[model samples]
Target: MIELLQDAHFWVGVALVIFLGILGYAGVHKIAWKLLGERGLKVQAQLDEAGKLRAEAEALLVQIKAQREAAEKQAALMLETAKEDAIRLGAEAKVKLDEQIKRRAALAERKIATAQAQAEADVKAAAADLATQAAETVLAARIAGAKSDPLIDAAVKTLAQRLQ
Candidate 1:
C-alpha cells in the first residue's frame, strides 16, 4: 500500500474520489435533509393556521346568518305593522267620508223641506188674494149699478152670507 501511494497518479486519484464522495454527501444528504425538514415543519404550521382560520370563518358565517334572519323578521314585522296602519287609516277615512256625505244629504233634505213649505204658503196666499179681489169687484158693481137685476142682487146677497 505504501508503494502504491508513493506513485503520484495513484494518490491523486484516491484524493479526487474522497473529495467527490464528501461533496455528494454534503449536497444530497445532510444539508438537503435539514432544509427539507425545516420546510416540512413550516408547511405543517401553515396547515394548522389554515384550519383555525376556517373555524373562525365558519363562526363568523353563522353569526352573519343569524343577523340576517333577525333582520328579515324585523322587516316582516314592520311591513305587517304598516299594513295594519294603512287599513286603519283607510277605514277612518271611509267613516269620515260617510259622515260628510250624510251631512250633505241632510242639508239637501232640509232645503227641500223649506222649499215645499214656501210653495204651500205661496199657494195659500194666491188663493186668498183671488177671493178678496172677487169680493171687492162684486161689492163695487152692486153699489154702482143697482137699478135692475134682482137675480144679481140675490146672488150677491147669497155670496155675502157665505162669506160671513
Candidate 2:
C-alpha cells in the first residue's frame, strides 16, 4: 500500500480530485450554466427581433403589391379616357372641317351667281346700246333727204305720252 501511495500516478490522481473538489465548493459549474443560459436568452431575443422584421417586410410587400395594382388600374383608365378623348376630338374636327368646306362651297356658289348676273346685265346693256346705234343708223339712212322738225316733234310727243 505504501508502494502504491508513493506512486507518482497516485499523487496526480489525488491532485486532480482536490482541484475538482475546489471547483465544486465554489459553485463554478452553476456560474457557467447561468452564463450559458443568459447567452441563450440573448439569442432568443435576436431571433424574435428577426421574426418581427420578417413580418414587417412581408406586410410591406403586400402593401406595395396592392399599390402597384391600383396604379395599373388607374393607368389603364387614363389611357382609355385619352383614347376616347382623341376619338371625340377627331370627330369634332372632322365635323368642323366638313362644315367649313360646305360654307366655302356655298360662298363660292354665291360669288359665281353674282358674277353671272353681273355679266348678264353687262351683256344686256351692250345689246341695248348696239340696237340703239343700229336703229339710229337705219333711221338716218331712211331719212337722209327728209329732215323734219315735224318728225322730231312727233317723236317727242310719243315719248312724253309713254312716260306719263
Scored by TM-score, the top model is: 2
- Work out the TM-score per prediction: 0.61, 0.76
Q: List, residue by residue over 35-89, the lDDT tens digit for candidate 1.
A: 9999999999999999999999999999999999999999999999999999999
Alpha-carbon RMSD to native, per candidate: 8.3, 4.2
Model 1 segments beyond 4 Å from truth?
A: 1-30, 145-164
Off by over 4 Å in 2: 1-21, 150-164
True-structure RMSD for candidate 2: 4.2
Q: Which ten residues in a row have the lowest lDDT in candidate 2?
A: 155-164
Predictions in order: lDDT = 0.88, 0.87
Candidate 1: global Cα-lDDT?
0.88
